[model samples]
Target: MKVKFFFRKKEPQFNSIEELFDAVSRKLSVIISVESITMPYGKISFKNIFKNIKYTRANSGKLNHITGHINYVTLGLKGKTILTIHDVGSTLNGNKIKFFLMKVFWYWIPALSVKKITVISEFSKKELVSIIPFAKDKIKVVYNPVKEELKYQPKEFNASCPKILLIGTKSNKNLENTIESLKEISCELHIIGKLAKEQLLLLEKLEINYFNQFFISYEEIIDAYQNCDLLCFASTYEGFGMPIIEAQAIGRPVITSNMGAMKEVAGESACLVDPNSISSIKEGVEKLIDDAEYRTNIIHLGLKNVERFKIDKITNDYLNIYKEVIEAK
Candidate 1:
């Protein structure tokens, strides 16, 4: 039986999901669905990149029924389907009324009707059960696995002025608070991903100097990790913090929130802060900036903590879930 992966690209171009699929497939026949946001790329490229197994393309957005239909077709009609739910925080993170109403339409309806559920973090699994308890037994926790080979050499720390890398699109990243933190410090701040209109407006109002970086490759991200003194995650919420692990793997200390699965992944390796408070984020960075010995300690803990998440281990977790679905069928 063939396995189909459903992925929607919110951004114009990126291969985060594709890279994850590459780590999971070997002897199995794989199918990929791209959620094309910009100009549509050829579906054949996905097949070629994925060893010409099978692939397709579709428009992005709330298409739960359409997504289920696509999986049914790709899985040979009678084949069991495994659906991966990335995050439910968008529903819960914002306005309560909007979040509540959206879940009735975008989340619990056609979305929970899957043969199997793969979640990236325990935090997400908890959120899923809270929102849609019917999907609990079918849910499986599989952390996003990043290959170790992608890691590049880290640059030597420059003690002059620290460089803080804030990664994420302008929307939902809480950049206004981040900019407030920047004002308190003298370090150069680098921002990544596309900006939402409100974020741009906030940046203009703050009058802070920031670089809008467009990344063409993972190497660009790696470069940011290498050069930066700290990776300021500063996100209000996430299912699993991918960059936290990536930065730890690359020997950079992370400043992330203590809420949700962020703390689960970061543990004691990262300096936890109240993401709502710009003062808290500023204080965390100052400790790292002023204390040389503290930086060494955190980096050492980070190196050790990163080893806990091997890509192969997580891949095996996915394999076990796949086997369960097949056996049940």
Candidate 2:
């Protein structure tokens, strides 16, 4: 039997989904012949979309899995197809016309082409079901497996001068709020994504020490995890917060938003704070800083939390689903 995992070409700075399923496909190769097809053109304009669809159809395998972020490409496939929807929050948040178009092309029409749908978190599954109630039975919640490269790297908590790692600069990441929360705190804020001019100015004006880096390799990401004292991922919205578990896997305490998928993915392992309130985020950060015992406890729980997202376990989950789809009449 043969299986093909379809992926969108990696953007210069982001390819988390592609990286994730690539690992799964590598493990799956031990059992069956598997191929990875990256679309020639990135998912953009009508011409590029049409080209990607045609290319995907020509290269389709017996069982096709469209990894997250390019679900609309499933429109051109046939046979047993599995599509992973990471989150609809980004797609559905916009002007009315854009929202309606994304709802149809990205979600509704694509739902008709695939045999099964997989979501990264239960929150994402519920969000998808709410948008297309008819597709509820077809949806499955498949938690993302933590990258194998991120091992448990123990680091001494540096309360004297802590380094707080914050990933993503997108609006949903609540960077502005986090920056505000860190204003008076004496710690270097290490931000992973591109920062706006206004953000940089704010950091300078507030006298908040920060280190900014963008378009780095995955190795750099692991390095950031290893070097930091704690991870602050207080995002306002997420389909699934991978960083929460990634930090947890690296044996670091996490301070994340209390609502949405962040809360769900973190379970009882993270210091939960209200994403909307700067005071709440500040409190969570300080709690992890001042109380070494509490920080150690969180780190312990985080390591245990990551076991649920083990790569072998998650890969096996996909293997079972693939078998069910391939053997279906």
Candidate 1 clashes between residue pairs 3 or more apart in a chain or in different chains: none
State the lDDT of candidate 2 residue by residue for 93-211, as single tens digits: 87999999998999998887788899999999989999988888889999999989989989888898899999999989999899999887889989999999888888888989889
* Candidate 1: stretches off by over 4 Å: 9-15, 26-78, 91-106, 109-112, 196-207
Instruction: Report the Cα lDDT for residue 281, model 1.
Output: 85
Off by over 4 Å in 2: none
What is candidate 1's local distance difference test score?
Answer: 0.66
Question: Can you give the TM-score per candidate against the true fold?
Answer: 0.78, 0.98
Q: Lowest-lDDT window of 10 residues in candidate 1? A: 63-72
Q: How well is each residue in 251-323 modelled by candidate 1, as lDDT tens digits?
A: 8888888788889888999988888998998888888888888887888788888777787677667667666
Give me the displacement of residue 249 in model 1, in angstroms. Answer: 0.9
As for candidate 2, its clashing pairs are none
Q: Give the per-residue Cα lDDT of candidate 1 at 11.
A: 44
